[model samples]
Target chain A: MTDSGFKKLVLSHFWVAFGAFGVASVLGLYQVVERSGLIPALQSPKVYFASVSTHGVLMAYVLTTFFVMGFGYLVAVSSLKTPLWNPKLAWVGFGVSAFGTALAAIPLLTGRGSVLYTFYPPLQASALLYIGAALLVIGSWFWCVIMLVMYGQWKKGHPGETVPLPMFANTANAILWLWTSAGVALEVVFQLIPWSLGLMDTVDVGLARTLFAWTLHPIVYFWLIPAYIALYSFVPQAAGGKLFSHELGRVAFIMLLILSLPIGFHHLYMDPQQGKGFKLAHGVGTFLVALPTLITGFTISASLEKAGRQAGGTGLFGWIGTLPWRDPMVLAAILAFGMLIAGGFGGIVNASYAMNAMIHNTAWVPGHFHLIFAGTTVILYMAIAYYVWPSLTGRTLVSRTLPVIQLWTWFIGMTILTTPWHILGLLGQPRRISSVVYNSVLTLAWTPYELAMIVGGAILLGSALLFLYILWKSQTAGAPEANAEIRYAGYEEPETPVPVLLNDFKLWNRIILALMLVNFGYPIAQFFFTKTFGSIGWGY
Target chain B: MSNLIPVHPLEKRWIYVVLGVIALFLGAIFYTALVHQVHPPGAIETIDSATLHLGGEFAEDKLGVRTDADGHLRATLVAARYGFYPREIRVPEGLPITFRIASADVLHGMHVPMTNLDTMVVPGYVSTVTTTFPKPGEYPMLCNEYCGMGHDHMWSKVIVVSRESWKAAAPQTGR
Candidate 1:
């Protein structure tokens, strides 16, 4: 585990992941408090949107991307049992992404480009913001190249052998990201860049929206892949069960990689720019993508159940309680997975085509995503941090009890905050309103939810503080414990080869090529075919 | 020996049955929903004879509203620029009526939980919103979307009329 070959690269990624996460958490607390509207002095819609936008981009895009990249490095090195094909290039990618983060933060913090986190067109950010975001993606592109090279290099070195499972999942994620980023990259480079630079007099909103649609939804899988890898490779074994069908795990990853894109039209469902036909096409694709999630849910949930049963729980569902809740990783996954079920259920309702009208542009939308991203995904990221910190830094985790409490309080707070958000959406509360100042019936309905959200925000802020404290203290105060080795659960790799479709990327690549052609071909064609109507030139 | 060992429970006989059932159910539902969505619009226009016919009730079962021949919405409003249609368009217990609705002017979004009807009415365009009334008590026909200068007063009422009174105030009554 010395810093020579594989561990060196893995450690580099882990450092970046934790470093970004710690900073993001500090910003997250500020965001929640300011957004609460309780602090009148803090209430500036302009500042609030900028903060909200940056906070979202950091946690969702920046933090998640870096952490996932780091985790992928670990999987590649250990599981593939190979040195990273180009460590120097991997470092180059890291530098690019970090530089991009710094550049993007300038406009975000200064209110120079407060287009909110989602860089939808008509409202443009500074050219630096677009360039910075592009560089970040470009850096990730380098990671993608390295990943593919490593996979190919491994296969070449060991002819006729199956790829390692974690590497397979890791590479699947890399491919997913490459495909996922293309949509927005096109939008950013072509539409946003020109608009921001004032090179283009008028930008096509529909075209811009259509191109972003390509990246909008699939990018979520980029965030979720590491979590999925953990679910497949780490969670089952940690729960004292065998990998519950390795093939199922591979199938899920492949399904996810292929299915996530092409259907991003689900986001454009309400927008008039994309036609009903394309919407339907993407809608069906949306449902198809759900299959992988269901597989993950069933496989992971069943694995946990089996783990619980083995630990001496009784009854069909009774095994839930027998599992250890004390371990930070275990406790975190349990809480995180619980959020996934609820969040995933809300997603089902959202993707219901017609039912979407119920929640579109409502507070429910953010509520649902926060539950998924912050509640489920970030908590697991925390778990990964907690687990890796001791091993990586050679220091004991300070206040293990605090990490557990932080995870729980975070979970409880997210649920309390988000449930009311859903109800409020139904109660006709718009998503991006600055404040509620009415005393009448509809406004009165919002009061209880707003009050509950304040409580939730406070709890979450406390949890964030505790998390940073533990990580900081571990860095400084914790006793040294050298010979700190990284560990994985005892689970035998399944001997059965997954069908070639799952293991083989070749077929999926071709399939994706065809699907994208059909899904996007005409929809994008229409932008060129028909004359567009525009009012405001691109606003920078 | 290159003969590969199958993964744990390689031939999972039990999984086949369960997954098979799930696949079947999923396939059926997927097809039905797809068909329902893709089907050509069934334009069933109602004949409204009354000057003001009660349209979609605010309920939990259906969506949108149904109207009669006279073209006036057979509906209720808590207040309109402010007005609620006469309260007698009632259905029997558990029976849900279709609310076919359209606005004569600006955009107004409507929702009633008892009938589960929610949709918007746009001017000129015959906007059809529907719902079924399940509960008996008067429910507020909330203007979920803001409309006018008088938006605060834009509410309507729903009087879930029983079958007996419904017949008494039937179109033949002309009252």
Candidate 2:
């Protein structure tokens, strides 16, 4: 592919993603106001649930999936220094996923699929929602196939050579997605679709929840891997420092891939349908996942430390100031991790089987997710967008200042919104209620917190609009003469022969499988020996 | 600040001060988490003995209030999906009583608001919560958890009347 040719493909995926993002943001703002219960006129439970379901699907599935797929394609093409193996197939994936999105929207927007966004049993939405979601996953699987093929092709072309860091990281993520999605994919295909369609006599709710949990935890990794890649490979370079360690990067990615899969049980902590042995197994596995996060925290911090030192920072943590905060990529990385600490810590608590009781099904659930996904992951995606816009369009950025403003606002809004949400959860505020109208002391306690959330929501709404304006202006305005593709830290990968095991995944996959066998082998099996759980029919 | 090793060109001392400020901020959150106590919601007082008796709505309708300081008595009435029966509860101020509590129809949390105390009250289970009415005002008990329609309307006023009157009424009400 020509230089601009690859960019156009990437940009197309981005355009689709941003289109979805822009739409989702508007829906999101409505949801915030709609759920707040301050305006009685806007507080129809039907409309509120519909808006929430659509908003979640649009943001969590649509925006993340498309952006990650697009990022994967571009990163593979550019970083691998190779052509996209099947461009037509990639577009086909896009077409199918987009079509699936439209189909899903028909049901979600009509207040039909208001069973909430989760795959809980007895609470059923329309059959179309389940089917459309399945199609979307299938479409994503098509992208997964293309990613793996591109990866294998690259390996074949350059035997014994290390894959470019970006491609390697991207491939690891693709592999993780395949392994992780199997559980949910099976659930959707076998359990949900059939039940929703009325073909199945009854569905086992416990089994469905357990399987979805398998997909749920690892899926966070799928959304997050791109952000991590941007952190490991792009941020240091953007900050004008060489990557601190290629070897450590490999370990972190591999650890993430393996750790992400086995720890799927954390989501089942509060679920009664799953047994204690299984929950304990998953809970222990949850702590194992924390290792990779710690590794990541140290590695990324050290990398930033390096970047700071290179920019002439001295003393421990003093160099943190020397690092460029103005560069959108660098700023995004910085902000991303700052949110990660708050979000990640909440995740650890959620994973702690003992503490799960504290926040189960509470507002704390959304609070943690919003901080992680919206605060950290989405910002980096936006950072990538900001960086890529000029290169793809042959124009300079419309306003460098606006990107930073948007990032800062998103961070601030999330902190304002979610901190209180966590507190509200602790205060016995159940999620999904429009109002705590009972006027008891407990409900009385929630009023101040709810008021704070409204302010946070307003700030975030304005910030999202500012983001659209920046992206839109970049597309149409800016100096048409400024399009220079940048390279990694201006340093060629040091010419060296690395061991095959260190450099590639020949043995890693086997190691992962074996570890997974040891890890999840019995936990999954215990489901059968235990008393057969009674089936709960589809609920609406 | 003393370990601020000189390293790079254009490195400013002012930057170090800013970093120090941030370090201090993060340090404080750690300090708070380490030193602070996290009080989760739960049953603060437990009644293992048969001192406090909890029964269902049928039992509650025939319930009598024990006396307290100032001769006042009180009780908490819970609201559920079905129409409220035994909606009024009698409680004695300063007098501990076993509240035999049960919902007439769906499950509910038999919550005492001020004490941050509650227990799940299932219909057949006859879940009871017991506490002394330390002070007397018209303490309104409401169904906070969702049961169904009339959830909002499910509430009863606890009148902590004088012990003399409660004694006179208790015999008549029990009879």
Candidate 3:
């Protein structure tokens, strides 16, 4: 089923993603160690901010975009049982993205682009960084086009047929990305780029933040939908059971797409540009988005329960022990869910309009996101890589036990790293600082948590290296495994023909546009109408 | 739709529970916001950040705690790349203190440890957060957002004295 060209394409994207991940992990360790204030020789705020910026861009933008693109390609090809639409164009997109990454890396390494990933202006970075970022997103737009085109073509060929569930979710992600990226895209092209290039003397900081808030929340769903895909489509089969409910999976994906977009103002709750009415509106939308996640938790748990019972488990709690624990995918799912629960609790706090003031911009923000992004999302990316590596490379994984061990270490390392981070946040330690120079009793109490973070970061670094080694060894030297074909989980019951509203996205797109207009229309337009001031660019 | 894809009875019940949980959270948020008047800092006041230091409420002498004509307490502060203006402020406990902070350059954040006095001071906007300090003590006011290379060093001190002592001390200068 694997075409050599398509195989090479997927592997290339994955390599870029993991290569960026490996470098970011090293930088992550350096940051924790430097910020700990124990290593006198390593405490340079100049270097620390630069490293933090690069680490953020690499992890948040580079790794996520590349991995999601590669995974989407694999799912489209394998699940749809079709050749990639315009293979040449796909390679072109990859080249553009890779070149953009290289261009961005130059400024990032030189300390000229240390504006951090959020890059809130008038704190400016090099214009090249914004341009490179714009190019990277432009390249990804090509993937969105490819995914949508293939989706349309498949529907045309098989009228009224239910699309493969993985592809269904993947296409939803593509549409979501198209909408999500537009916010940052507008900001970068019109505001940041011009201001950084000296074409504009000053930028409306409120408008810039408003546009970014448009991208801030929904972009999370873009990274997370792929993880959900793995959970719904792959984890069940890997756990030796069928999916509990196929319709519910579709419902969750659509709900995530619509509910996630209008709620981004929750990020701007603390800002003065928007009014309380709009903030409360967005706050409500934020909680509404949590429904899909809860549904996902319930559906996946039920699927596993059924699987466990099917394997000769009798008692109420015996089903848990009966499931496959050694399987990398199964273990990764369990770990991912455990972290999601923890991360979700923190997310609820962030969403609460008033409670947000307690933790906004503190270390708690980073702790919550790292658990969700690095812990839950990226861990599942690793599991998906392990699951499909055999099919993609035509080789067996180098060591079975190494992956199991790797997943466990990643989970344990994240728990260690984020737990103390939350505590430090509560103790009123700010994030994105090089050291605690206050020298007060309150500052003294933060030293222990800083040290704990170092240990957690070291463990995570080691685990990341192990993961890359497994992938490299498997691709290069391991023997080929015969009959390495890809298969998604089957349904518990035969899949009935889904309604057009559930199967198609036309209605959802309309709802999203209407929601965006209602939620963001006045908030953004008021910036143009009111007497607002713009600030000139400033450099660190 | 139901005939096309009937949901599992257990899953249907779960959906109701999910809605109930969401309602509870929203209810709590609305109750506090409407009844108690506890809301996020959202004052939509604008200022020219570049020239903020020249002459304004955030000028050098005009900063720090002040008493208004209505006998209300207010604090005006300036945030820049490195530190907060005045670097230290003394206020009375058990009184509602309105903090009107503006950034001179770039974006900054201010938070007093163990209090709800937290906000982002965007360059072009004034972040106004009002709250009462119940406990009288010295608290560290830390810059929680990354402003520049000197971000870690960007902090100040807040001395919360008793209301009686605040009256005995020199009267605040600015109106």
TM-score of each: 0.79, 0.77, 0.99
Q: Write the per-residue lDDT of candidate 2 for residues A340-435, one digit (tens) a residue.
A: 889877876676544554565467778889999999999899888887677677878888788999989988988898898888877766555545
| Candidate lDDT (C-alpha), each | 0.67, 0.67, 0.92
lDDT of 1 by residue, A232-315 (tens): 767777677766666667777888988897888777554545555667667767777777777677777777887899899999
Per-residue error (Å), model 2, residue A241: 1.2
Best by DockQ: 3
Instruction: Name the regions of candidate 1 deviating beyond 4 angstroms.
Output: A4-37, A314-318, A437-440, A489-499, A538-540, B1-175
lDDT of 3 at A122: 87
Q: Which residue pairs does candidate 3 place in steric collision? A: none
RMSD of 1: 8.0
Regions of candidate 3 where Cα sits further than 4 Å from its true position: B1-4
Tell me how far the alpha carbon of residue A425 in candidate 2 is from the true structure, in angstroms, after superposition.
Answer: 1.5
User: Relative to the true interface, what fraction of contacts does candidate 2 keep?
Assistant: 0.01
Candidate 3 local lDDT, residue A133: 92
